[model samples]
Target: MWFHGPDKMINVHKMDRTCMALSFLSFDRKQDRRKQSAGAAGRKRFSVDFPFEAFTRDIWIICVSNVVGAFGEGLYFWVFPLYVMSLQADYIQLAIVTSALMGFAALVPIPGGLLADRLDRKKIIILSWTPWIFAPLIYSFAQDWTQLIPGTVCWGVSMLGLPAITAYVISSVGDEKKVTSVLSFVWASYSFSYIFAPAVGTYLATIIGMRSVLQISA
Candidate 1:
């Protein structure tokens, strides 16, 4: 986390050491930690397997949270560029707007990682939800393309909590073998929501048009 910013750090040599250090600093469950040491200490699994205890309460919390977040993003993630195009933003303006949103996002991960280490990961995630609350509203009410700058800003700024979300799930359990398994679960959980959410968003778009869909995303 210190070195990787918001990027996954499971590959870093210090990741194990970091995990060990985090385990000591975090909650205790000797029963869980004992299970972690028996298998491969550091290997990433791309697929989810039943042998891994991947459906625990904490994991579900992350899954559910990811679903809700993904669902919200899904409503607009695909339609956003189209919506901006509807605003008639020229290529140059669109490029600038996209850059503004993405540029801020890149800066957030560094602070996000630092905050993940210093603060409660759950709380950080909870706080991160605040931007989504208003971001859609900003999009819904914006009368002109320029007004969307703030809306895009909120979406981009939300990247600040990404590291905390990733770190929270990996560090939730002390086992290294389980880390990759949990990572797979987390990826699946967040991704699975997209399968349904986009369809739902499309349905709603037919009923209310794109701008109102942004409001519902809130």
Candidate 2:
């Protein structure tokens, strides 16, 4: 009887230990599941809020190119009036030049839209951007304000790509809902260059001449 009593007690203890171990394992699994769910929720929230998925490969490439182009243009565009005055342009001549720049840019959109619809958008963008490279070079070599007319025209010509860029960006995204965010992101990226390029340009112009800066920007 004494041996049987101890054996029952030991068996009961073993059963209790087994139950406790099972409970612990179950609790651990639940904890792991909870952690995994929480992590997944965090990742999902991040993806929804950050617009990361909207930046597809083509969009990213365009954003990078926009930054570079904006920076290059900003380097001299802000100080363009001063550069004009330095070239002995009177207020009237400056106004004429500015008007010509704006007028041509405004007019190009009509044909630009047609071209964007008919031509390969990528090629349109490339062709339009080509004028900008030469525009600043023209500006750098100008002897007088009259000579800047061609440069201003070239700058205006570069606006021909604007429609193509917008159309290309819209077409590049698979998700329609992400279009606004993606476009805003791209525009914001371009604006980033203006924040710093003017300061850098001013500093460089102090070290080098404005013409040299324009040449460098070109």
Candidate 3:
């Protein structure tokens, strides 16, 4: 029925609204299904099974290698300041020594990355440790800048192996996802060792002196 003058009335059926709601729900369900299918396909394409043997063996080797490196790093970092102080070096000289060692260490990672792509990473790591065998011995005899400079440079070069060791672990594990967890564990251990190393160095320096501390570090 239509009303005259200024207004008109119309009736709408409730069934139409119900139909619209149902259609929307149906569309949503289809979208969800498509998403699920895509996710499953993606997972199938990239998911890697945990290689238990490889994981265990590689983790052990990485741990041992990192521990050895960490031991040297902690001692080197902790004792250097003391060593410089023993020489009665002024702040400027100390800064120079620190800069030389750290700057070279920072620069090494770039070339090390290139080498890592082409070289056997494990061999690189072993070769890196070889420098430690002599660096400390040389530092023990360092009475002036001449001896100190070369020893510090060698220490910096030795650190170049770090990235290679990391690359080896990642490659050996064969799963990129686990790299963070593994590295976290290694770094936690490294931090713990660093905390205690200074105390040990201080005690040793008091007893046997700075040269002995450098020898022990090496």
**Which lDDT values do the candidates have, in the order given?**
0.78, 0.89, 0.72
Model 2 C-alpha lDDT per residue in residues 1-218, reported as the tens digit of each score? 33368889998889889999999999999999999999999998776656777777877877898899889889988999899899999999999888988898899877888999999999988899899889999999999999999998899888898899889989987888778778888888889999999999989999999999999888
What is the number of residue pairs that collide in model 2?
0
Candidate achieving higher lDDT, 1 or 2: 2
TM-score of each: 0.72, 0.78, 0.69
Q: Which model scores highest in TM-score?
A: 2
The global Cα lDDT (0 to 1) of model 2 is 0.89
Q: How many angstroms is residue 7 displaced in model 2 relative to the true structure, after the best TM-score fit? A: 39
| lDDT of each residue in 51-165, candidate 3, tens digit only | 3334557567667766665666566567677677667688888888888888988997788778888888878877877875677778888887556888777877777687887
Q: Which stretches of candidate 1 lie over 4 Å from their true place?
A: 1-48, 51-55
- On lDDT, the stronger of 2 and 3 is 2
Reference-based TM-score, model 1: 0.72
What are the runs in model 2 whose C-alpha is more than 4 Å off?
1-46
Assess candidate 3 and give its TM-score to the true structure. Answer: 0.69
How large is the C-alpha RMSD of every model relative to the true structure?
21.4, 5.6, 7.9
The number of the candidate with the highest lDDT is 2
